[model samples]
Target: MVRRPTERPGRNDEPDLPPNLFVIGLLHDLKEGGYSRHAWAAFWRASWIRSIQILEMSAELRASWLRFSVTGIVLIALSTVAVTAYFGIGQGIPFALTSVLWWGILMFDLAMHLGLMVNLESGELQQTLGWPNRLTELRGLAAVWVAWGAHWASAGVYVPLVLVFGLAAFTDLLDGWLARRRHASTRWGRLYDPFMDGLFFSVAAISLAVVGILPQWLAALVTLRYAFPIFGGITFLLIRRRTLRVRHTPWGRASSAGIALTVFAAALAAALGLPFQALAPFFYAAVGITALGAFVTILIRGIEQI
Candidate 1:
């Protein structure tokens, strides 16, 4: 006798299988004699449903992203107006243009990676953007402002630079605190926050060095503190096609705090006409200890992950 082809479920009088049945039956057969005709049908149907869901989610995500992008632009414009009004039109225009440029680049990059809220622990996607993420984005904009301020530090405007950066750093602490308190920690926030922190402090160090507020050696240490991890992350992503998750460590936090404190002190001292040479020892000790600790910790932890 010849073997007849197996009939696929839901093809004749059989009732359409429920989604769960599709998953369960497909999984069962997959582990047994491979995909039976019913399993193939279930798999195709399940795949179709998932494809529809993804497309719908993508559409909704675009709409939400547009709203978020518009808000960012409005805030950037307002910040430019306020800064220009206070600082005069000459520096104001250039500063505004630069801030807009930064915002555009950041927004474009985020749009390309378009994703909805992702739970920090479960890695599940959600529809809403929580306040923690909103605050993180706010901090990112503040970082752009700091970069502009850093560029102008050479003009002897130490006080303003200090104030701008101080507020930006404060937001860094605030975002994490609020995320924990609200139980709204997210993967995107975790990733974006650290990147912004690195950008914020790196600009502070390099700009100050160029302006002669910080010594070259200290600047290199600060830059390398962030540069190595960032480079490593990019390399890992390129090779593995996935992100390398580096857990926050005490040493990392200490390094960031040390850099911020050093920048604040140097800027304030310059503003007050205090001799920076007297403060050199303090800078070296703070940045040196923290940077070394952070560098070592990151290397060890990163290796463990690899």
Candidate 2:
């Protein structure tokens, strides 16, 4: 018996198929894959692509800055060694080590600013703008290293270094305000801004600890603000397979401001030859309260998401 035309196998009687059957089949396979497998693949792909792009972009962007960086580093190193030997040989080096350290920091900051500008302009021109996570990561690492160097300088010349630290802190505030006011804010700025702030505070706390200007407990408390949140963020991303959305929460901003002020106060007290121990209790208390507030805010937000 002849089948009806409409009912013939592989004819219009069959379910409609995609014109690009191969592409459709591949997409279907992707969706059917386990979530973890798909997630890992996506993560690795994103990370690999980002690394390649950042390396290429950074090479172009930092060419001039790298020259400056090398020159500055060499000069600073030579100055440091010379000053050390002179001091050992009973010839006062006329300049504080802290000054050299600050100079190095300023140079590093200039390099970073240059890199950031190049990256932002390139992104705009290419219409490839998005959050620059790799650049942000690099900036964060740089901040931490700078802070470490600053702390060493502070320990060597505590009073003069405090001034440099204060100025650097102020620049952090100014840069953000300028970016916002000029309407030049970008995804890269948002990530870099906070990472720098955290690094600055963390480094300052380390400096204070080294000089016995702050109680160990106080320094630890301040460090925990950044450390705990960082850990939490990593955990969330691993479990949820997504980065936490950046938000400008009032409490978060307040916490950061409070931390900065506390560090500034501690530095001032040290510089003034005041008994910094008395302020330790207050510092610890402020850190605890701000940290608690920040934690509660994060917890509430996490719950809301659920």
Candidate 3:
């Protein structure tokens, strides 16, 4: 008598099962095993849950920082206006200058706190979003912003502010080096780092101009340091349809160092009440050359990529 296929037993199967029964059973087991574990783990993990919590926390933090930054800027502006009002208030020796400088300090503090928040946000985003080395970028930009604010505040003081500014400038370089050495370079950090440097330098130049410390021509050149790059960036974006990349170049590094040194030297001269005019020509020349080199580098690199 012939048994049906399902009724037949083979060595591959259990003694009670047919030949195809084992294959069917294995498939069924695999299907039942499915992705449930993955789903369950994702929902229950600390990292995932903390990401949600951090979103809310970051929102609150960003709000607080924005409020503080705005308020500080407004106070600084008002304090500057109070400079004229000092004469009206009958205060001796322009007490409003002190108020303005104090406002600068407040602004600096706010900027620093904002930077801290950025660092925290970058760190959280890295884990939550799979971004690499973003915290390093954030720290770089933060260092620049902090340095800028310190420089502004120092401008309102004598030599003490310059020392603080110098320290901050040094930290900006140090932070970038640390980031690279520590393997913490990220896209966000790269973009923001140079952007913040441009902003800081622009603001410093403008502040010096406002205080009559920087001659108008030299101030214009300093301002162009930012404007030239920004214009190039915009042009490149418009024409080439590519965002500028931050390449490590010796000339670029030297240009930055030169500009920083020039600013320090100028500040020192101002503090000493010495004639800073001789330094002005050299400073402007350095700025112009650097700006030109940067522009050429960006333009050439951008075009070559296309």
Candidate 4:
């Protein structure tokens, strides 16, 4: 048989290509819309249009995010200073300074995670951080101050602790409701809310334990109840390269409520000069039961996600 010249793709005056080669070349041409130069021109033009549109839109999105973030930072700084100063004065200068330092560290940590404010559905930056998120931050700040002040609370100064703890508990209830009512929920709110809750209660548990309000074992259990889900979510993200959607299980909420109530009850008792130590067993049983329930339920739910 005589040998035939092999046709090159995108060439004229050549023999037709074999079926597979022809299909490949056709697909390549389709990538640019068609084989004609006009098609190629149109393809490049459309690509440029899309590129410009994306650049313009992204710049606006970034600007919007920056505005809200800056405003939020300012608000957080002002609130931290005011609250810490008010609560820390009763403790001491050192306590106030330490509280400020802790707040700074926490705000810095929050800034690191604040980039999650994008809408998961559209993958776009949210224009507004929303009042719900602002309220959540306020709640976290109050809880943090209370946790730190729990040490200085040895001076029979449980008033501020009770008030701050109450504020935290109230905001925890209100933030989600505000988010739903305003229809301003975002991926950031979903993730940040739980994280703040965990941070608040974990530190509160440890602080309460340090001050002899909660037993060591119960405190550890309370801390672990929030800690495990956060650890699991991070693990899932690292292993799967996707954000784990946090599911707010009833058990989880019940655990949080139990922990908060226990903290409040202890603080209130201390303020009233009552013997909370006598109720240690009751606190232990309640927190322990709820924590165990939340741990198992959340773990199973997280595993199901995986």
Candidate 5:
């Protein structure tokens, strides 16, 4: 027996999509008499009308998100200011400047996002803040928070800083996994996600050194490992003047994992009052592994260029 052909989606034989809630809510002001007089004509024209209506809704939603995000960042900066003032770091004034600098950086990044947003058509706007991008935003903002937290992090109060760093580190793995599973990877995300990861790790590494949890030499190694790839990619983006799609290299991934583990362990050990001297061997071994992996990644990338 022959089977009936399956109906393709979004064509004849498929049921109409439910109207967007934004459209329904938007039309609440319509008079009952008006609806009764033109309901039939409106049904025939609903598809075209709703498409335009949804486009407007998309833009409205985007505006609302932009407002929320900007306000949230401002609040973070203000809170950092209060914390800095309370902590008296850099006599309270210098750290306030740091907070300002952080806010400026955030604004610049937001500007980059806005530039991309303006170029998007209506459909792209609808999908702008999908699960993966939301994760990316979380990851990026958390990295900034870690950096700010480090500035105010005291040796006496290490636990909070450790918690922030740990959560930010988790977002790295999570965003990558979700992006792959959801097919929501964007070029901007590919660039910024690693940049944020590197930025957070670098900031955490330096903060550890500042707190004497890590020695200067080890901190240097960790910073360089993260910095090399980040600067190289930025340089490429500037020079190429086109879309750049850079995925994580295998060795790079291993390097990040190893470095994060070492940072967390070192911070935790310091917080627990464990002597850095006692765990010097373990910490150094991890650093060596991370450095070796990073070197191999660079060599592999260089070889590909040849």
Candidate 6:
């Protein structure tokens, strides 16, 4: 089943953020000195210089632009790797990278779109985002790429795969804990945090399924479990041109946690030389909770909209 893309946010209720120092300074100068012919003529030159200086020194400006630049660079690097592998390296690149590339660009747009909101408010933006939180999203993206690696990973390499996947899963929890500890939760976090969860877990499930590490039936459920909300989110953004901002719910968190645990269990069962049937009990329970959670979340959002 095709699942909708997950994502969202709105800002009407939010108070306007203040302009950065450059703008504030210009405004202050004009208000204090009033407009004179020479000063007015010189103002543009001074403003341009001051703006450049401020942008160079401003942490927020650097951070926002830096994120966009870095993502663009990654895309280029992926493309280069793909081309090199196909041509120079005599190793064919996986076509899956195309999907990964587009997904990444979409995420890049989302990051910039959200980052711009708090850009002018350096203090607040810094408070709302940190290296740890950003790393979580990057980890999610890594999981997506890693999922493709599952195609090549099998019985012999399953151990390393499990350990790598475990790290990605750990980051999911780490980001939120870091945010809460710092009191840095923001609209971007609320919207994109779960979005990353869906992406990471879904891709991993699909890859594992392809490699026979997971049952096709279980993979389908897991995929749709993430797809529904994600596609719903993407649809919302396309039509409304804004984020959905669904309230974080208990069941939703449980669903994500359940998926992470269940996948780990599946990997572990393989690692331990246990039968797939042995994990049936755990998988069934996790699926039940996950499906139930998705239904409830969809229902709640429906009620909210009405």
Best by TM-score: 1
Question: Candidate 6: RMSD over Cα atoms?
Answer: 12.1
Worst 10 residues of 6 by lDDT: 10-19
lDDT winner: 1
- Provide the global lDDT of candidate 2 against the true structure: 0.54
Rank all candidate structures by their lDDT, best first, as comma-separated numbers.
1, 4, 6, 5, 2, 3
Q: What does candidate 4's lDDT look like per residue over 1-306, in tens digits?
A: 112377334311212111223223434554556347876676456545544454355555445445655664565566556656766545455554555565566555544444445544355556555677777776666665776558657766776678878888888888877765655566667777888898888777788788987677777887788888888876665454455546466787888888889988987887898898888678767888888898888778677767
C-alpha root-mean-square deviation, each candidate: 14.2, 14.7, 20.1, 17.3, 15.2, 12.1
- Please, what are the lDDT tens digits per residue for candidate 1 over residues 221-262? 888888888898766644443456545678988888888888
Q: What residue pairs clash in candidate 2, if any at all?
A: none
TM for candidate 6 is 0.64
Question: Could you estimate the TM-score for every candidate?
Answer: 0.74, 0.60, 0.52, 0.68, 0.65, 0.64
Compared with the true structure, all predictions reach lDDT values of 0.70, 0.54, 0.51, 0.66, 0.60, 0.61
* Full candidate order by TM-score, most accurate first: 1, 4, 5, 6, 2, 3
Cand. 3 TM to true fold = 0.52
Q: After superposition, how far is residue 44 of candidate 5 from its true place, in Å?
A: 48
Query: RMSD to the native, candidate 1?
Result: 14.2
How many clashes (backbone atoms < 3 Å, residues ≥3 apart in a chain or on different chains) does model 4 have?
0
Worst 10 residues of 1 by lDDT: 10-19
For model 2, residues 127-202, the per-residue Cα lDDT tens digits are: 2222233233333433433444445446554543566566666666666555444445454455456666676677
After superposition, the stretches of candidate 6 with alpha carbons farther than 4 Å from their true spots are 1-61, 64-107, 114-123, 127-129, 234-243
Better of 2 and 6 by lDDT: 6
Which candidate, 3 or 6, has the higher lDDT? Answer: 6
